[model samples]
Target: MKDVYLFSGFLGSGKTSMLTNVIKQLKERNLKPAVIMNELGKLPFDSQTVEEDIPLKEMLEGCICCSGSEKTEAQIQTLLLNEDFDVLIIETTGAAHPVEALDAVYSPLFADQLNIKGIVTVADSKLWLERESLTPQVRSLFLEQIRHAHLLLANKMDLLSESEQAKVIFEMQGINSHAFILQTTNGQVSYKLLENLQATSRISKDDIHSAKIGKHLHLSSLLIEFNKSYTQQQIEDWIKTLPSTVYRIKGYIPVEGVKNPMLFQYAYGLVQWLPEYIKMPAKVVLIGENVDEVKVIDE
Candidate 1:
């Protein structure tokens, strides 16, 4: 089983940078690592910032939950079989729910290929408190994700004053005493944390809040699938993913003539594309529940 680490954070919370730094540390040990980047430019602006490229694959503009769809486990199985890396790093979008991704991977299909090393949640210390309530319930979602993490990386502390950093740390740890909270700048968290850390103590079933349907936990995902064709440019211009009721949006986009499928991922207004391969069928899958999915799909 490979060590699978999930990096989740709120919009602009520096999740990408934190993930990149961790991958760098892994590479330094001469450990072959595989990275499954959710969206091209959603967080931390892609992997170009980090020099590790031997086994990098971008989901291109959409998240794993949205991009993988019916083929979710298949994609993961593919990653495990094809990539020679010892560790798999996944960077989720700011709007993504850690529970949803966890739910996806907990499936029996990936039973042999993967093991949950732990979850690392990155938070932008400077904006966390302020954005906690300003944007679409992101603060709540962000906190929930952190609550589930084995390691909580409080990133962008350099943007905060020393005292402010302390306060943020205090508030974060207060949520989950079990979480290994670390104050960091530019996502420079150490790999030792992962190596040295043991797995989380299994909580009594009641200890962890029961994930409810209407609650943050996703009982089901509503998909808006478009059978028609679309160009990469068209999908980029039309799609928007965020932290509102619409948690995240992404899917396979086929630019008619392009050989490879063009993926589209959007979160909190940070839109990114492959800007290279353009594929077809353009089957776009949008994941959202209740009224939000309707708003995007019915339109």
Candidate 2:
């Protein structure tokens, strides 16, 4: 049976970075790895991060826990039938609830063919500290992800001071005492640690059914396509004008005077722009509560 591992985290929690590291380590150990990446947007921005050699599948435009369950099953079946890999890694959308996502993977069609390892949840140290500021529904989803994790990563430790790190660790441990917690920078963790992890005994189909968790959160996404190039300052100024309800914004933006569009990521008021050599679509996907109603570009 092939081993299956799930990666769960909120937006901008460094899941893709962790997935990249895990894939590199797995390859070094002579183990073939396959990936299933879920994205809330139509464009597969994160899927591009996976290497070409690895067998990869993408489920887009929905969260795996809700609208994409059937599609996820089909993708898994396709990989199992055509790919030769020792392990399968599923990176769920940040908005996905862990238990529901797990339920989606437990399809009877191929349950016996795979060994479900567990979930590795990445928690942003700074976000955990300021979770109280989030809307109640969003905060609940954030905590639920950690609560169901078997191995939790307290990521972005480098951004915090020593005392802040201690506090974040304490809070995370307090919430999920059973999970093996690690302080990490850029989502780095030992592959051996991941290989040895066991699924949390608390996660069962019965619990998931009893909870009846659904995609009830008011969160929505908006895709913004740029018609013309804009200065970096103009984009940054517009981002600053956004309300706190916006959780994440990511995609490529056409920057004035730049040959290629830059990758932009904004999460919880923090903004980052990375230069990309290859030109990508000049579009951005904004994910948040009532995001569809928000005007993305200033007229």
Number of the top-ranking candidate, with TM-score as the measure: 2
Task: Please give, for residues 92-157, the per-residue lDDT of candidate 2 as tens digits.
Answer: 998998756875675544655677677899999999989999999999999988887878999999
Clashes of each: 7, 0
Judged by lDDT against the true structure, how good is candidate 1?
Answer: 0.60
Q: Tell me the lDDT of model 2 at 217.
A: 25
Candidate 1 structure, TM-score to reference: 0.61
* Candidate 2 off by > 4 Å: 200-299
lDDT of each: 0.60, 0.79
Error of 2 at 213 (Å): 26
Residue 151 in candidate 2, Cα distance off native in Å: 0.4
With a 3 Å backbone cut-off (N, CA, C), the pairs that clash in candidate 2 are: none
